[model samples]
Target: MSAKIRLYVDHLLGPGQSVELTREQAHYLFGVMRLAVGGHVALFNGKDGEWLAKVAEAGKKGGKLTCQTQSKPLHMPPDLWFLFAPIKKTRTDFIVEKAAEMGAARIMPVQTQFTNSERIRQDRLQAHAVEAAEQCGGTFVPEVADLQRLDRVLDDWPETRQMMFCDEAEVGSALRLAAQEKGQPWAILIGPEGGFSDRERARLSGLPYAHVVSLGPRILRADTAAVAALTMWQQALGDWL
Candidate 1:
């Protein structure tokens, strides 16, 4: 049988240390999953590599586990960032989850001129990324960044990394951009629901590292655009290549 997987953020895991789970994690393990004493599980931290562990004790509130052995080395994906304007709460969570699953190294919430959502809970988004990584058997979790203005992110753009701008107004095919972006550190940018302002689009188009791409004929929602853009990027310039 396959070993059950459980992720924890606590440090100092080893043979004799007792690791405490968060309240929700405890509920899932002890209540929902009914993991009992002596059951085996796998765990990982954003820092340490994955470890094989066993439940030492199970309680109503929480449980204790002992690390037994290392399962996989800590591996991070290629330098790919997902920059998107924040949307509704559930949609934002979905974006973060999908970004982690798709292997983005960093997730940035950009505040664009036409962006509808202004306030974002970074902690909650980070939690979603962690959960997604755990579910996907990933050793590393993507870093969730706090909300920042689009202009500032552009101003501080790294010269070496290319940016694939998912421009809805563009009529060209996504594959063209994908082929051109091969063999370079890249980022995929998705605009807000209302799309990028004229000025913002013009500025982005003028950037040396920015390559505007289209995700086919139909206009996709901001959430769908993010996923499609990432898929194209992963197939072209990312680990999937």
Candidate 2:
């Protein structure tokens, strides 16, 4: 039988396998969703494929589900990492949510010279990613990294991963990314509200793996830039192609 609800679980899923739900999850399903025993619920755990499960036991404090059949195989996203400076609380949450929905394999919050927020609740952001995956019909949930300085992150950059740096100063410049080869590791970097520092821009430009591009003829807000950059990359060299 098909289920209307899709849930992100933390347990293995296989034929006839029983899965235990956390109290919060139980509350969400039983209390909020009003799902009763024997009701069907689709489940996924990031690692395993999506499964159609039946609620075996439902309670206020906890619940259990039994996997009946595989609904869909795990479809992994491209090796794309999304890096951006955290803005206000709501906007940062919006960025994380969109990143997960847009097929980002990993989400990172970098601390730029002009970054407004120094600290970020990584756990909360991770939860946002999970919810985004659940709502957007994504089998994979991207990991949200803790806040780190931009320079330090660049210093340890992987040699093989290319970075798409969206430069605010290059508003009128052409977005030169269509020629980049696909099916390789890539990252999209969006600067903070105040934009990147001169040193940061210079360092990024000099990097062999960084491709600096302008979003358009105008400077976008940090959150808007992230979505624009992701859409551009996905269309050019990402899975959309």
Candidate 3:
């Protein structure tokens, strides 16, 4: 039978290798999904691509599944980073999800001068990324980095990677990313709710590797701007086209 459930596991997957499901996984599969023993399920561990497996053992607390055969090979995303300030818990989670679905290699929460939130649950956000990857048919789950000060992050920024600074203040001056160096790694920065402060914008502007591009004529909320920026980047320099 064809496997319908796609699960993201942390264990290595290969023919004959059994994966022990966690308590939560057990509930999702047997308890909630009502998957019975010998039922098929799709699995991936980020490193091993996708595999078709069956429920070898089933229990309420936990269970086991053994890989039968490989389904798809590992598909890595572009070498891209999406850096944004933490907003409301749900919105921040949304950004993480979209980043994962859109093939961001790494997700980072930046502490901007005008940032609305000062901290984030790194583990929780990482889980969101995994869920997004599973639903979007991706093998690689991008890393959700801990909250860091924007200035500090820029201070040690790699000179080789290009940065797309989404400047809300540069609305009229907005330009497409067509001229960007597609061969190099890229990162997109989305500002906070109140937008980047004057000092923050100036600092980003002076950075040699940074390009201060506007999103559109009308301003967009931080979360919306993130989706817009990622779409533009993907269409222009990412793997989308």
Best by lDDT: 2
Clashing pairs in 1: none
Which stretch of 10 consecutive residues in model 3 shows the poorest summed lDDT?
Answer: 171-180
Report the number of the highest-TM-score candidate.
2
Per-residue error at 169 for model 3, in Å? 0.7
TM-score of each: 0.92, 0.98, 0.97
> Any idea what lDDT model 2 has?
0.92
At residue 87, what lDDT does model 2 achieve?
Answer: 96
lDDT value, residue 41 of candidate 3: 91
Residue-level lDDT tens digits of model 2 in 1-241: 7888999998999999999999999999999999999899999999888999999999888989999999989989999999999999999999999999889999999999999998999999999999999999888899999999999999999999999998888766655678878898999999998989999999999999998888887769887888888999999888885
Q: Which residues of candidate 1, in runs, are more than 4 Å off?
A: 13-17, 173-183
Reference-based lDDT, residue 145, model 3: 96
Residue-pair clashes per candidate, as listed? 0, 0, 0
lDDT (Cα) of model 1: 0.84
Local distance difference test scores for all models: 0.84, 0.92, 0.91
